[model samples]
Target: MSTTYKVPIGPVHVGLKEPVTAWLELDGERIVGARVRPGAIHRGIEFMARERNPIQVIYLSERICGICSFSHVLCFIRAIEDLAGMTVPVRGQYIRTLVLELERVHSHLLWAGVACYTIGFDSAFHLGMQLRERVMDILELLTGNRVNYGVATFGGVRWDVTPELAKAMREMIRYYRREFTPFRDIVMDDPIAHARMRGVGVLTGEEAVRYSATGPTARASGLRIDLRKSSPYEAYGDIPVEPIVPQDHFGAARGDVLDRFAVRVMEVYQSLDVLEKVLDGLPEGPYAAEANLNKVLASLKKAEGTGWGIIEAPRGDDTHVVHLKGGDENVYWWKVRAPTYANAVSWPLMFRGNELADAPLIINSIDPCISCMERMMVTDGRGDPRVVTRAELLERCRRKTFDMMGRRA
Candidate 1:
């Protein structure tokens, strides 16, 4: 007779960066079923967006997730621009594309680092993070911020990449091109990485479609549905955009953890190439269209309309829907659907039939962002501490950091 038990990891786990609870039902060593709960960090961003004016909402949207911040604002701004029937300057379009690609490089690098760490490869994890800093430095140069780059504005970008900055970006890409080969070799040649990743957390193409998985997760499962190519927003239409499904890189897509990692790594190269092309042919025009917010708001008030916008964020397609109120500066309705929401559906499928020991790597493979998918968490006072004072919270944070550092040491 087989024995069954349940294993609960997180609400706070060393493996996860955000708040997520995973309950796994195990039969011996294998997981028979799993449930993932998200949303302890929900701040009602959509509701908050409805309260702010269009201009203010740009900043509000940017706060959706620190990593996907620019994508959020871009989707929101594009929705507003579409509602108002405004055109973005050509150079503005190019710059927007450039910033987004740079963001992709950084995001992918960050995920790669996390994946490495999850697999217990500290060297690759550190190397991935170190290489990622160059991308962050460029982001800082362009937007004056390392995270939450507030560059995309309504109908255009706030800052232009000057000739010198463009040159610097080119050099950065060149450096990445030189360094990526060794990184790829390290991940691909490692027998342990293959043993751990291949055939693990396999999601078939049919299953991926059923769950509506997106980004590298869906691409790994042989879905060729990148919004950049399918929808063609911003400069995607002007430049040829190719979706890197797993089969394109590997002979056949296994739709496993290894395939997901391969797709993201290949995408970093593709984004670097796209950046070069966008910069080389960057059109000459103003960074932002000349228009006063008051005039734009008046027009929107007189002729209110609903608009929907979608952009291929690093993780996947991020979408926004907005309805402008007649004779008001604020929107009547605002909706945001992030990639994590779509990808969340596949978690249970990935965890089923896998070992409990593989939980963290399987979870990391999807790159779950619980913060983006807001829900509710209830804690009963019957057996729990009611209030967590600031001192406790601070001490807990410090202890976690110290533990992590100790492990590193």
Candidate 2:
């Protein structure tokens, strides 16, 4: 008879990048069952939006995720524009698309490097990180900041693609095309990488659908679903994007860690193509419909309706909904549904029947941003609701850390 033991992978673990707890039921080294508990950090960003006007929320949304900050900002801005009935100029649309693809490249590179690091492939990891700087440099040249780029605005982008910026972007695209393949081949062609990743952390196509997995997670499982292709928005309408699936390229979609890795690697190439198209067909017009902030706010003040903005973010479909009250200058209520929230649902399924050592790789396979997905509401033992203040939360964090270190705070 076999006796099962319970093991916890995280809340704070060396293997994880972010704080998330996974309780695993193990029989020896093999995982029997798993339960994932997120919400280690609750930012309360959506709740904070209620106090600020539409214009102020743009910056707030950008802080949602460092890698995909612009995705959140664009999504939030689009939601507000939807309610306000504002139109983005043609040039603005193309510029928005350009930034979106650039962000995708940046995000994929970071994730790939992190994935390599998770598996102890340090050389590939370093190469990926080095390759990522090129895109970041172009992003900084265009928006003046690499992360949390304050580029997207209410009606359109705050910045325009000048001739110098365009030349830099083209150069960056060519650099990636020439340099990225060697790094990708380093891992993908390695027998040791195949031994570790192939057939590990499997989530079948049926499982992906049942769990409502989106983005590359779903695509890795052989689902040909891409929001850019299905519901074309922004520049995706102009530039055609076909979803990259494992079966299409590798002859079969095993829906394992390897497939997920392949999907993301291929996407880097796809983004390069999209960036080229965006630059070649770049339009000439006002980048922002109305650059005057006061007028944009004044127009939004009178608009009273709920609007949604959904886009194919780097991870997956990012959705934002905003409601504006007629007389109120501040946003009435706001909600965000990030891609990690959807992709995380399939984690337990992937964890089943895998080794305990594979836990970290499986969790990191989704490229999850725990901060983007966490939303917490505190309550007492009797189910009585209570608000946990910022200072209280900080104290709790300190106490937890001290306790873990076998000390009293």
Candidate 3:
């Protein structure tokens, strides 16, 4: 009989983008079992929401994930709108969709590059990064910020698609159409890439459903589920979107790392199509229902109820739940369930039978955002749960900082 050993692959591994631990039961180089431990990077974002009003929380929501910042903001705003009975203008809806697709393109390109880098395909990685800059440039031109764009507001978008901005968008669409295919082809056609990825982290369609996998993670497993396609919202209602599945492009959805990669690559093209449709169908009207912030806040003060917003974020479906108390200016409570929370559940399933070297690729196949998924929970040494007040948390942080400084000195 072979000896079995336990090895922890994270909390601070170079291969992982965020702080998450995977304790692997290894027999030689092959993984026999795995347990994922997250929460190393929890920031208590949901708890922070209680102190801020709806407007202040928008910026806080944006900070949840730099790549899909708008998704969080939109979801949070939609929840608030649901309670307030607010409706965004048609022009605003189209603009919101435009930004959403742009964000998707940005997110997919970044992930694709990182995926290449993870497998030591540095040439393709660099090219992918270079290609990504064009979309970021367009985003900056439109919103004045490349990452946490303060674009989406409660009722509608803060900025309109100016004629010049519209021209830039059209140019960007053409640029990606001409350039992106070759980059995708480079990796998809590479034999070494196939050797590294194909059949390496298999998660079946049935397994994905069982695990509640979302976004590309689920689609890669051949699940025909995309919120944009199934439950159309905003401009998606006007410009229909079909979920991209591996079986449709390839003969079969092997439900492995390669299939996940292919699904995201194909979805980039799908986003481009959506972007074009949004531009063509752009309407003329006010972007926000009420541009005045004070008035919006005042109206929200009288509303009291629980509201939920769910949207197809870059990685998967992003959900936000908010509760408001009547006559209260601050948000009573809030909860966020990011895609990584759902996709990470299947990590152990993917890890089974895979080699030690393939751990990073499989973890990354879901394009996880650890910061988005993390939630704070304090417990005593005896395992009894306890609530740490904000003051106590701050004191602990300061003490830790001082200790680190003294050690360095």
- Candidate 1: deviation at residue 206, Å? 0.7
Q: In model 2, which residue pairs have backbone atoms overlapping below 3 Å? A: none
Whose TM-score is higher: candidate 1's or candidate 3's?
3
**Full-model lDDT for every candidate:** 0.86, 0.91, 0.93
Pairs of residues at least 3 apart in sequence or in different chains that clash in candidate 3? none
- Candidate 1, residues 1-409, lDDT tens digits: the string is 9888989878888887887778899999899989876646778777776777888888888888898788888998898888888889989999999999999999999998899999899999999999999999999999999998889877788888999899999999999999987987898789998898999999999999998999889999998989888889888888888899888767998899999999999999999999999999999978788557676566766647778889999998888888786677777678888898899889899998999879999988987777766632334647442445579778977997698568545
lDDT of 3 by residue, 267-345 (tens): 9999999999999989988888899989999999998888989999999999998888889999987889999999999
| Candidate 2 residue runs with Cα over 4 Å from true position | 381-409
Which lDDT tens digits does candidate 2 get at residues 329-375?
Answer: 99987889999999998999999899998999999999999998875
Model 2: lowest-lDDT 10 consecutive positions? 400-409
After superposing all C-alphas onto the true structure, candidate 1 shows an RMSD in angstroms of 10.5
Which residue segments of model 1 deviate by more than 4 Å? 301-303, 375-409
Please count the clashing residue pairs in each candidate, in the order shown: 0, 0, 0
Model 1 residue 370 CA deviation (Å) reads: 1.2
